[model samples]
Target: MTALADQTRWLDATAQAALVRSGEVKASELVEAAIERIERLDPGLGAVTLRYFDQARSAAADGSNGPLAGVPFLVKDLLTDVRGQACTDANVALKAQARPADADSPLVARFRAAGLVLAGRTASSEFGTTPTAESAAWGATRNPWNTALSSGGSSGGSAAAVAAGMVPAAHGTDAAGSIRIPASCCGLVGLKPSRSGARTAVESVMDLIVPSVLTRSVRDTALFLDIARGDEGPAPADGYLAEPGKDPGRLRIGLLDTRIDGSPVHPDCAQAARSAARLLESLGHHVDPGFPAALGDSTLDQLFAAFWSAGMGDLLADVARRLGRDVTASDVEPLNWALGTLAADLSADDRQAASEGVAGFARSVVSWWDDRDLLLTPTQAEPPLPSGTLASDPAEPMAPLLRSTQFAPFTPFVNFTGQPAISLPLHTDTAGLPIGVQLVAAPGREDLLLRVAAQLEAAAPWGERRPGL
Candidate 1:
C-alpha cells in the first residue's frame, strides 16, 4: 500500500472525507488502499466473504456526489442486497446461490447517495442466528486484537474488518445483540438505531431487527446516520446531526452493573462498568446504580426467548422452502434446531402473549427513560471468549450451546425494547481485550445518545489504541 493509503486507512470516515473533498487525496487512492488491506489482512481474519473491488473502483472513478465521497465500507452479509453479490449468510446450504439484486436496498442506496464506496460484504453466522461468528461455510472470524479470542458476532466480520483498518466503517444488524456484542469485542463504536431508523421493509412474520453501522469514531457513525437517515420526508424534531455536539447538560445517567436475568457479570466486565460510571460522575453527570424496573420480571426472558426462536424458525423455514429443500434439524446449527422445535410448539395464543408482553415492556422502559437521559451498562457480561467457545457442532445437543452463549446479557434487552443503544470502547482488561460500556437512550433519541457519546469519547480517547493486527 502507498504511504497515503497507510495514513488514511486508520483515519475516521469524517477525516477521510474531508481529505478527499479538499483534493488532498483522491477517492480511488483511498479505495485502492482499502482493497490492499483487505487482501493482505482478510486472508487470516476471514472477515470479508465477497469482494466488489471493480465496482467500487468504477464508482470512485465516476466521482459520486455527497459528503462521504470516497470512504470504503462493507455490509454485513445478513441484511444487505448488493447487486451481483452472493449472500450466503455463512450457511453451507445456500452457498450455491448467487443472484443480482435489481437495486440497492434503501440503506445501501442511502450510502451510495452519500458517495460512500461499497467494497464488499462481510462474513456472518448462518441466518445471523448465533452471537459468535463461527460459520459452517466460512471459518471462524478471529479478533484482530488477539487471534485466539473471538470477534463477537453475527457482525463479527464487520467489526474485525473495521478494527483491523480494512475499512473505516461497515454495516451491521442487531436482531439479538448482534451489532453491539461484536463492536464491544472489537473495540469499535456500534449503535443499534431504533427500529424506526431501519431502512429495510418490515416483515410481519419476524421480530424487528435494527440495522446500523460500526465505526472507529463516534463522528463517523454520526455522519453515516446523517446520510442514511435520508429525507424520507420531514426530519424528526431532533434532526440527524442537528446537534451531535450539543451539551446534554448535567444528565442523570443510570448505571446498571448487574445482569437483568439475575446472572452475575464477570469481574473484569463489572470493573469496566464502574470505570465508566466514575467517568460520567467526573464529567458532572449524576451516575447512580439503578435497574430498569421493567426488566425485573423473569417472564420477559421467556417471552424474548420464544419470540426469537419463533422468528428464527420462520426465517429458516422460508429459506428452506425457497431453496426447494425440506427443513430438518440436521441441516442447521444445534441451537437453531432447538429453536425450530420450540417454535413448532408455540401456539398463536403463546405468540400473542409474547408480543403483548414485549410491547408493554418497551412502554415501561421508554417511560423510565423520560426521567433519565441515558442508561449505562456493560455491553456484554464478559469479555470476548476464546474462538470456537460459542461454536456448536451439528452433532451436539442444543441446550448447552444456548447456555454457554448467554454470557452476553447486556445487549439483547435494547433489541427487545426497540430502544437506541451504543457500545463504546471505554475500557480494556489486563489481558488487553476491549470491554465496552453501553449507553442506551429512549426510542428515536439517537441524537442525544450521539452527543453524549462524543463527550465520552473526548473524556476517554480510544483512537490511538489499535488491536495487535
Candidate 2:
C-alpha cells in the first residue's frame, strides 16, 4: 500500500474530506488508504464483516462529489443497509442466506449524497438484542485498546473500526445504547439524536433505535449529523455544523451517577461522570446532584424487557420470512433463542402494557427536562471487560445479558424517552480503558448537546489518544 500521509488513517472525516475537496489528496487515494488500513488491521479486530472495496474505489474514481467526498465510512451490519452488501444482523441464519439490499435505506442514501465512500459493513449483535458485539457468524470484534477485551455491541464493529484507525467515522444506531455503549468501550464519540430530528429508514422495535455515527472528534460527529439528518427538514436548514465551538451560556445540568434502576455503577464509571461534572462546572454550567423522579423504578426495566422480548419475536418472524425458512434456536445465539421464545408467549395485552408503561415513564422523564437543560450520566457503568462478558447460554441466557449491563442502566431511559444523547470519551480508568460520559438533551435539542460537548472536548481534549495497533 502506498503511503497517503502522516496519520492519514487516523484523520477525522472532516479533515479527510477537506483533503479531497482541496485536491491535496485524490478521493481514490483516500479510499485506498482506508481499504489498505482495513486489510492490514481488520483480521486482528474482526470489526468489518463485509468489504465493498472495488465498488468504493469505483465511486471514488467517479468523483461523485459532495461535502464529504471520498471519506471512508462503514455501516453497522444490522439495520442500516447498503445496496449490494450483506445486511445481516450478525445471526448465522441470516449470514448463511445473505442478500444484497436492493437499494440504499434512506439514511444510507443520505450518506451517499454527502459523498462518503461505502467500504464495508461492521459487526453487530444478533437482532441487536445485546450490548456486546459477539456473534456466531462473525465471531467477536475485539477492542483495539486491549485485544482481549470486547468492543461493545451492537454497534461494536463501527466503534472498533474507527478506534482502530481503519476509518474516521462509521454509521451506528442507538436503541438502548448500542452506539453509546460501543463508543464507551472503544473510545469514540457516539450520538443518538432525538426522535424528532434523527434519521431512520424504518423504526426498529419500540421505535427506539436512532441512527447516528461514531467518530473521534466532536466536530466530525457534528458534521456527520449535518449529513445524516435527512431532508425532511425538522431541523434548521443550516445544519448542525455551526453548533460546535459556539458559546453555550450557563445552563442547568442535572447529574446522575447512580442508575435510575438502582443498579450498582462501577466506581470508575461513577468517577468518570463526577469528573465530567466538575469540568462542566468549570465551564460555567450549573451541575446538580439530582435526576428525574420517574427514574430508579423497577417498572421501566420490566417494561423494557417485555418490549424488547416482543421485538425479538417480531425480528425472528421477519428473518424467517426473508430466509424462506424457520430460524431455529440453533440458527441464532442462545440468548436470542431464549428471548424469542419468551416473546412467543407474549400476549397482545402484555405488549400493550409494556407500551403504556414506557409512555408513562417517558412523560415523567421528559418532565425533568423542564427543570434542567441537560442530564449527565455515565455512558456505561463499567470499563471494557474481556470478550464474552455478555455471552449467552441456552440454559441461563438472561443472566449473562443482565449481568454485563448493570453499569449502563442510564442509557436505555433516554432511548425510551426519544431524547437526544451523546457519549463522549471524557475519562479513562486505572487500566486506561476509555470511559464515556453521556449528555442528554430534550427532544429536538441536539444543538444544545453539541455545543456543550464541544466545550467539554476543548476543556479536556482527547484527540491525540490512540489504541495499541
Candidate 3:
C-alpha cells in the first residue's frame, strides 16, 4: 500500500498518463490503485455514489495506448450520461427505478475517446438544485480537509473524490458555480468553460449549464478542454495543453471583492480575493477595483430564478415521463419541489420576458470585457459551510433555496452571462479550509482563463497541498 501510494496516489492525471505512455506503469495498475484508494477513503466523504470497478478494469486493458488513456475517472451524477450506467442525478426516485442510459452523452463519449476509464458516478444534489451535495438519495459529501464541512455542490462528490486522491480528476458540471465552489472547498482546480465553444447543455429558457472536470492541476483541465471541446466551435484545435505552459501576457484584470449586491463580503473570503489580486499584479497583470456594474442589478436575480425554476419544472416533466406517472412534491428534495411549483405557475410569456431581460443584462455585463481580460472575485461568498447549513425540512421548503443566494452570490452571474470562469485554490481561511479565487474570461476565452490560472499555479504552487484525509 505504501509503495502504491508513493507511485500513484497524488500524481495528477497528466503525470499518470505520462507514466502509462512511458511503459513505466500499466493503466490497469493505475485503475486498481484508484479503486483501492476509493474503497479506503470514500466512506467518510460519501463521494462516489456508484462503482463500476470491473468495467473499469476491463477497459484499462488497452488504456495504456495514449494520452489520458485508462486514467480512472468518475462522472458526476448529473446530466452527462455514460452508456449502461444509471444516472440518478442524486434523486431517490430514479435510483429506485435503476434504469440504465442507452447511449453516452457527447461529452461522455469524448471522455472515453480520451481513454478515461469510467469508474462510476459521483453524488450531486437532486437535479443539481443546490450547492451542497446533500440529497435524500445519496446523503452528504464531506470536505476532505474537514469532515464536518461540506464539499460545495452540486459537484461536491467529484471535488471530494479528486481532493482525497481517489481520482486525479473527475467530471463535474457547473450551471452556476458547482465546479468552482466545490473546487474551492476541496482545494482542486475547477474550470467552467464558455458555453459557445463547448457542447450545448440546454436547460429550459437558456443554455446556462456547462460541463467540466474538477482536477488537481490546471494542465489537466486544459488538456481536458482540448479533448472535451473536440474541434468544436472557434476554439483552437489542440493548443489547450500548451496554453498553460506559456506566459499569458500582461492584461487588465478587474477585481470585485464583495458580494454582487455591493454588500460586505466575509473577511476571509474578501482577503482571499484581495491576495489573489496582489498575486496577479506581481505576475505582471494590471489589477484594478473594477467589475461589471450589471452584476449589481437586482433584476438579474429575478431573471435567473425564472430560468432556473422553469428548468426545474422541465426536470420534473422529464422525470414524470420516465416514471409514467405524475411526479409529486414528495418525489424530489424540498427546495426543488418548491421551485417546480413556482415554475408551474409562470406563463410562457413570463419566461420569454425573463429570457430577453437576461440577454440584455448579459450584453451589458459582457461589454465590461471589451477592455478587461478578466474579472476576479471570491469563488464563494464565504468559506465552505458546515454540513447542514443549507438543509431544510419540508415545512420550510424554500429556506435552502433562499440561503443559496447568500452562499454563492458571486458565481451564478457568470453562468447567466455565458462566460468562462476558473477557480484556483490559493488561500486558506482561519479554519484551514481552502478558499478559491475565481478568474472570469470573456465568452469563448477559456484558453485565457487556463493561461492565467496556470501562471497563478506556478507562482503559488498548490499542487502538493493535499488534505490530511
Q: Report the number of the highest-TM-score candidate.
A: 3
Off by over 4 Å in 3: 197-206, 233-237
Model 1: CA > 4 A from native: 197-205, 233-238, 261-263
Residues 236-282 of candidate 2: C-alpha lDDT, one tens digit per residue: 22678888968989999988887665555888999999999999999
**Would you estimate the TM-scores of all the predictions?**
0.94, 0.96, 0.96
TM-score of 1: 0.94
By summed lDDT, which 10 consecutive residues of candidate 3 come out lowest?
197-206
lDDT of 3 by residue, 375-421 (tens): 99998887899998887578899898888878888888788778999
Best by lDDT: 3
How do the residues 1-469 of candidate 1 rate in per-residue lDDT, one tens digit apiece? 6687578778988888888899998999989999999998999899998899999999899987688898998998875777667677776666655555677789888888888999999988777877778777787999999998889988999999999999999999887788899999999999988877332233233457778899999888877777777885333234565555788789998998878755679988889899999998998999997768987786676877777767877878886875688876656767777777888888888877777777777777678887888999999888888898877665664643465446677777677677889999999999788999999988778878888888889999999989866
Please give the CA lDDT of all the candidate structures.
Answer: 0.82, 0.85, 0.86
lDDT score, residue 245, model 1? 71
Q: What residue pairs clash in candidate 1, if any at all? A: none
